[model samples]
Target: MQITLPRIGTVAAWRQQVRKLAAAGIDPQAVIWSVGAAAPDLFATAAPAPGVATPLMLSLEAVDGIEMALLHSDPERFSRAHALVLRLSKREVRWGDRSDPLMRRLLDQQKAVGREIHKMHGFVRFREVSPPGANRRAFAAWFEPDHPVLEAAAPFFARRFGDMDWLIATPTLTARCEAGEMRIEETEARQPPPKDAAEELWRVYFASIFNPARLMVKAMKSHMPQKYWKNLPEADLIPDLIRSAETRVRAMHDPSAPAPETLPGGRMRKKLR
Candidate 1:
């Protein structure tokens, strides 16, 4: 039986559908899953009523892992997760076994999604925008994420910026928060937003706080991947910063280094002598 799920299915939706399938004794092999709008399949059989019987439960760790794994960009993630869940329900198995390819892949996907979430939290830069007649200022950001994680990652923004309205738009989805409530919805490709005045200040602050003496390009890339650089305000300055790091650090250590000149706006510019 062909079962068409939503293009971006959530944990609750999958849980509800899985409960019905499990109650009806519909094994994973008997059903083929495709992601799209839910439409009546011409050759599909009607699903049976979900009985009152308690469905099989997975451990909390496994459940969390599968939920995050499902958010991965892999097209076959649903099928793989479904198969694993079926095997888990049928008998006792080490869900965390790395020796098992399926389990290992799922765990890896889960970790990738987790890292994407962290990146989104760190990289999303909101720009203030004002519409006529608006009382409180509204902010917006455009981002491109590697995984379908905006749904899972939106809550952090809602809690962090509860006092203001904000929108985070991505290729696949958008998260909007207003008056302490957050909503996620589908979106298409979007162009980069206009430059905000605040970005300049952020750039200056980033440059000032950067420690050239502690430069570690490899370790920095591991934590802050290059994929996210385009969306970050401080990223464009990275190349120049890295190139001049040695000079800056050497000047700082030199006893004969020229005194810093006071620039306009009380900023100090070190003259590398």
Candidate 2:
């Protein structure tokens, strides 16, 4: 039997199909699983009718793990998940048992999906896309993730930027929030959004918060990977900031250095005597 699943709501679709196949006593290896639009398989047969209603009896942990692992970009993810689900339902394999290779692989993939979600939350940079004088401000962002994580990661943005209208576009899909309602649709454009006026202010604020005396190159790179730098407005200043960190730190320690003049409101002037 051959099963082709739509990209959106894939987890729900897979669950429904797998239940029927399991009830029919079909082997996971005997079925061909393809996601999105694909050429029809020549030798594919019609799916078997479910023989009887049998509860899968999967634990909450197992269900969550399977759902997260399915979001991974690996083409074999569906088959592997299906196999694991069968084993789990039959009590043939224990959840979180590193002794089983299949269980271990699924666990690792689940963690990978989680890490990708974290990166998406931290890295997406939005720019204003709404025209001036618009009643509600709108913004847009472009992100490329290692996994199919837009569904998993978009809710964080909705809660954080609830007052404004925004959209996040990825290669496969786009998530848009308008009037407090969020919708997911096919991507309209592959290119990143245009730069807006506020980016300069964001860059300046980034520079101001940079602490040269406490610079840690490796740590910074770990938190913000190089792949995401191109999309960030503050990333352009990183090279210069890193190069000058030592000099700035030295100046801070040098007692002979001229004291910066204090301006009104306790702000220090940038110019030094």
In the order shown, what is each candidate's alpha-carbon RMSD? 3.9, 4.2
Clashes of 2: 0
Name the best candidate (by TM-score). 2
Q: Where does candidate 2 have its weakest 10-residue lDDT segment?
A: 261-270
Q: State the lDDT at 202 in candidate 1.
A: 71
Q: Judge candidate 2 against the unseen true structure and give its global Cα lDDT, from 0 to 1.
A: 0.85
- Taken over the whole model, the C-alpha lDDT of each candidate is 0.79, 0.85
- 1-273, model 1: which lDDT tens digit per residue? 776766554666777777777776676655666666665667666553333433567889888999999988897787788778877776646789888898999999999999999999988988888687998778999989999889899999998899999999998778889888888877764765677887877787777887879999999889878998888887877776777677667768985756454344224456754
Q: What TM-score quantifies how close candidate 1 is to the native fold? A: 0.86
Q: What are the models' TM-scores?
A: 0.86, 0.88
